[model samples]
Target: MLTFYSEGSRLRQARTELHDGALVTPFECPERLDLVLKQLRQSGLGEIRTPNAYGLAPVQAVHDKDYVTFLANCWTEWVSAGHKGEAIPNIWPARTLRGDRIPRAISGQLGYYALAAETSISEGTFEAAMASKDVALGAVEHTLKTGEPSFGLCRPPGHHAAYDQFGGYCFFNNAAIAAQRALDSGMGRVAILDVDFHHGNGTQQIFYQRDDVLFISLHGDPEVTFPYYSGYADEHGQGQGEGFNVNYPMPPGTSVATWMAALDQALARIHAAKCECLIVSLGVDIFVDDPISEFTFSSEDFTLLGKRLAHAGLPSVFLMEGGYAVEAIGVNVVNVLQGFKQSME
Candidate 1:
């Protein structure tokens, strides 16, 4: 399980996140990556390597060009507009408002492109996002080349982003970008299994109308979860992608047994799809102690989850997503990798 990481992730140092009604420190801070990296080194799971530069082409593949341009220039535009503090959206185009037009004002633009108000943009957000996608692309290359599992320790987790919208502490959809790269590299089919606490809305949106790539996610039910849209049991794929997209949305305090049952069903769907490659949107936020999410998974349960994915026997790429429990995130993440490695042995 080779791990791909980038020091550039340190540059995204936004200090504000809107939760409930007040601004507080972001749960998706840089320390999460530091702890995970430390555990990988101490556990001797595999070598931690810096990712190669893949540039914006791979990012543009899954994200809109204008959206990518907005992310790159958002911070600068906000600063130039004389706004104080990190860039956060206060307004959005709701159902009756005009969403087809792009706003000239930076504030309006922020709302126009943002899906939620929790994430803020700072000085180095664009650079760091670029590097994060590079890390994901590097893992895709490693998995394709070696036919072995690899991990992309991506910061600014990206499952919540869409083709043209950014939010949920994510600017660019790393897992979606990686899946597109895999398809571009001549693979017939690829399946993404998102075991994150929140639904992978962006990844599902990207492949929802396509049959070449299958998207599946098991997460907290959107009825009461963070992303309060999509992630329902009946929102199956449309047209050519019918029956390809799967969602197993469970309630809060979902037992490990129930979650594992959903995992078994997801795995069966993946196997039936005959996918040539597998990408796991790995998130440890489902841990019992996580601040922002609710689930009952323990550290040992993560190990079992990893082993189950390994048993599926497809070339795997693991992309890091949400996990705010700074103290135990390392152990839980490493447990998954170690379990997969040990299972392979």
Candidate 2:
């Protein structure tokens, strides 16, 4: 499988994120991708290349225009505002707060546009996030051209971002963007299978009212997971998208047996939907040792996970999302791909 990655991912590491009522270091760090790359190469996953740049149309397809403009220009505005460190959003529009106006001050706008402080815009964040998105888009392009599976080693993982909002260590929704690209290229029915430890609330929300794309996710149950809103089993699609979006939100301590069972159910639905292609939001954070996550899946389970997906017999594009167990992440990730290859054989 061809792998896509971006060196720009190293540019936007935050010093800390608010977690567990304390300011703690982030679990989704740049070194996670570095380690995954080393493992993929050593494991003979094939060569990886930098992404080719594309126009803003693909990005704009899923994200709001003003949000995209803000992402592109936030750091410049922050710098102009005399900010010295990273510009993390400190306030949010929740409950009775007024979200009616986009604030002129950078601080208020940051809160208005963002969901959490974990994802801050440093001087280089825009470029890094854009580059990461490019990597995913390039991988999607490769899959479209070759009809074979490819992996995008995207960092600053993007399943939490919405069309007009950013949070959960994400600024741009790369996986959603890739799905939109697939839809644009004549694939009327596409499926997004997110196996991240956390729910892909953003991806689900983007296509919730559309029937052209099918979004399915298997992740930690929202009652006990991060991005603590949405991700419930009852969040079936609405209107034109009814019965299209599926969420297999499992509880904590879920083992491979239960997880794959959920995967099988999701595959049944995908098959019923007659999806032409698949986009997997792959996150090794489900590994037992992932510091910030709660799932109990092991390295061997990932291989099993890949085999199950491959057995579904759809063309696939794997987008790297979250994985913090730096040592085992690559092995776990590559194991899924390798297992998929074996299944095909």
Candidate 3:
């Protein structure tokens, strides 16, 4: 299990975020990735390597070009506009609002391109996002070349981002971009299983209307969770993508038993799809102590989840996503990979 990482991920660290109407230190901080790396080294899972630059082309495959450009320039635009703090959205297009119209002002563009205000764009945001994107694509390339599994240590987790909107501390949809690159590289069929506590709304949106990639997520019920739209069980896909998208929305306080049951079902669906490769949006936020999430999974439960995923018998790419329990994140994440490696033996 090769781990792909970048020091550039530290660049997007925002000072604060608007949570519960009060500005507080962001839950998605660079320290989270640091802890994970520390654990990977302590465990000696595999060699840590810097990623090859895949550039914006692979990212553009799954994201809107204008949105990418906006991410690249938004920080400078915000600074030039005389804003001294991190750039957070003050407004968003709502019902009856014209979303099709692109705004010229930095303020309107911030609101237009941002899915929510929780993710504040800082100075190194675009740089960090590009680094994360390269990490994911590099893992995909490595997996293709070696026919082995690789882990993408992406920061500012990406499941909450959409094709054109950024949120949930994510700018570029790293997993979606990697899946797209895999398909383009001639992997016949790929299955993206998002085991994040939050539904992969962005990944779902990117592949919702397509059939080549099968997206499955097991997360908190969207009715009460963040990203309050589009994670319901009823959204099974549309048109050519019908029956390809699967969502298992479990209620809060769900136990590991219930979560693993959902994983079994998702794996079954993936196997039925004849998936040639697997992309796991590995999020440890489901841990019982995770600050912003509400699932009761114990650390051992993650090992169990990894064991089940290993049984899927497909080339896998594990991309880091959300997990606010900074203290235990590394242990929990490494538990999954270690368990998977042990199972293979």
Candidate 4:
């Protein structure tokens, strides 16, 4: 497995995250990538390559132009507006409120583009986001060209970002962008299997209305999870995308056996869809000791998950998503990659 990464990912050093009505240090910090890189090297998984610059075109392919513009200039605007602390949305266009208008004030604009208030924008956030998408794109290119598996160690993970909103510590939808790039590169059909602890709401929304890309996610039940709005079983794709989107929302403390069963179902659906490429929104937060998520997956289970995906026998790209257990993150992620490598042999 070839892994794509960027030192620019360390630029996003936001210090604030809203949790339980109080501001605390963010769980999605730069060290998450550091630890993962360390483990990848120590485990001798494969070559670690720095990603090439793909610029905003790939990002604009999956995200709205205005949203991309907002993310690029948000930090400068917030600072010029003289607001104190990192930029976090204090208000949002809730139910019955006008969401059509883009606000002029930085604060109002933050609310306009934000899906949740947990993520704060700091200096270099835009740069880091750009690099993160580049990493994903690089991995996609590698997989498509070589017909092999690759990993994108994306930081400030992106599954939670929607078409025009940034939240859940994600500024840009990296996995969605990678999938779009794969499609643009002439693949007939692509499937995204999100095994993250949280549902890939942004990736779902990006491809929800298209049949060319099948989106499937297994996550905590939205009723009790962080992103409480989406991720239900019934929120299937709309229009031409009907029957292409699948969600398996399990309860808290879901056993590894049950989770593997869900993976089997998702793999079966992908095989039926005849997808030419596979993208895994790899998140190890399902680990038993993760603080934010509730699941009971052991480190060894990740190896089995990787083996199962390898058996699918499609060109694969694994994009890093949510995982807070900093110490074990590397082990779990590398376990998956190593398992896939061993299985392929």
Candidate 5:
């Protein structure tokens, strides 16, 4: 598999994350990518290359234009407001609140566009987020050009972002953007299989009403997980996209067999859809040791997971989402890629 990455991705480091009603150092930090790169080199899979510049057009395909503008300017606006220390949203438009109205204050805008308070916008957030989008787009291009699977090692993971809202350390929905790019590039249909530990609320919402892309996610049950508002099986899509959205929500401490069972079902759905392209929202946070995620998947299980995905035989693009087990993250991620490579033979 080819790997796409960028050093600029390290710039979106947030100084603080609002967790459990308190500020703490973020779990999604720059070092996560370092270990992934180290393991990629050690595995001898492929060289990590800088991504191609796809620009804002591809990114805007999946994200809201005004929201994209907000992301690009929020950091600067925050700085100009004379308030320091990474911009974290303190307020949100809850039920009964007016969401249609855009706030003029930078502080209010931060809250308005943010899905949650945990994702803080640091100085270089917009730049790093754009670089991450490039990584995803470049990986898609690699898959298209080489006729082989490609991996986008995206940072500040993007599963919890929505069309206009950003959260869960994600400023832009990289996986959704990649899927859209596939469709825009003339692919008949695209299927996104998100195996991230947390539900890809953002990706699901991006295509919930569109039939061109099918979004399936296997993640921790939203009933007791982070971003606890979405991810139920009932959110099967709306309008022309009905039945295109699939969600497999498992309880915490879910066993590997159970997880794989869900994977098989998701794969079957992808096969049934007859998707022309595949995008895996690859996240290793389901590992037993992941700090913020729960699931009993051992490192070796990732290999099997990858092998099964490879069995599908679709041209695939893997986009990194969330995996905070910093020490073992590299080995786990490489295991999946290596497994897929071996399976392709």
Candidate 6:
């Protein structure tokens, strides 16, 4: 499998994050990607390459135009306003805050467009995120054009970001942008299977009202996971998308067995959806020792995940999302890819 990456992605690293009531080094650090790449090399499945820039046009296809502008200028605006620390949101448009108008101030706009506090930006965040989106879109283009699989190694993972709202270590939803680009480029029925540890609330929000795209996710149950809301079993799609959305919210400490069972069921649903292409929001944080996730999957179990997805028999693209098991992330991710490659043969 070809791995899509960009060096520019490292420009936006946040120096610290508020973790456990104290400021600690960010778990979503640049070293995490480095460790993952090292593991991929050690595993003998290392195939990596950078992508040609796809520019802002592909991004605008799935993101709100004004929201796109906000992300591009957010860091500069924050710095221009004299705040120098990491750009974390201090407020959000909760149940009471007016949602109709976009705010003029950087903080108000940050709160207006964000859903949670997990995502923080530094001076160079927007460039890195846009480059990351390009990485994912480049992979999608390769898969769509050649009917072969490619992996997008994006940082500041982007499943929690919606069309307009950006948070959860995401500025723009890369996988959603790629999936939407696939749809626009003529894939009639696309299936997005988010196998990340956290629910892809942002991806779901974008496709929940559309019948052409099917969204399925397996994540920690919202009852006990981070972000604290959404990801419920009852969040079925609305209107034309009613039967197309699927969510498997497993309990904490879920093992490989239970997780695979959920994945099997998701595969059945994807098959029923008659999906012509598949996009996997692959996050290795489900590994047993991952700090931020609850599922207790081993590194080797990722192979089974890849094999199972290959059985679905569709053109596929894999987008990197969350995973804080920096040490083991590469192996876990490659195990799945090698497993799928074997199954494909």
lDDT of 4 by residue, 1-345 (tens): 899999999999999999989999999998898899999999988899999998888888888999989888999999898988999999989888998899999899999999999999999999999999999999999999999899999987999999999999998999999999999999988999999999999999999999999999999999999799899999889999999999999999999999999999999999999999999999999999999999999999999988988988899999999999999999999999988888998
Model 1 Cα RMSD, 1 decimal: 0.7
Better of 3 and 4 by lDDT: 4
Q: Which digits, one per residue and each the tens of the lDDT, describe model 3 over residues 29-69? A: 99998899999999999999999887889888988999999
Alpha-carbon runs more than 4 Å astray in model 5? none
Model 6 pairs in collision:
none
> Higher lDDT: candidate 4 or 5?
4
Most lDDT-accurate candidate: 4
Q: Candidate 2's error at 101, in angstroms? A: 1.1
Give the C-alpha miss distance for residue 108 in model 2, angstroms: 0.8
TM-score of 6: 0.97
- CA shift of 144, model 6, Å: 1.2
Model 3 TM-score on a 0 to 1 scale:
0.99
Which residue pairs in candidate 2 collide?
A: none
Stretches > 4 Å off in candidate 1: none
Q: Model 3 misses residue 214 by how many Å?
A: 0.3
Note the clash tally of each candidate.
0, 0, 0, 0, 1, 0
| Minimal lDDT window, size 10, model 2 | 115-124
Candidate 6 segments whose C-alpha is farther than 4 A from its true place: none
Name the runs in model 3 displaced over 4 angstroms: none
Candidate 5: count of backbone clashes, pairs at least 3 residues apart or interchain: 1
lDDT of model number 1: 0.92
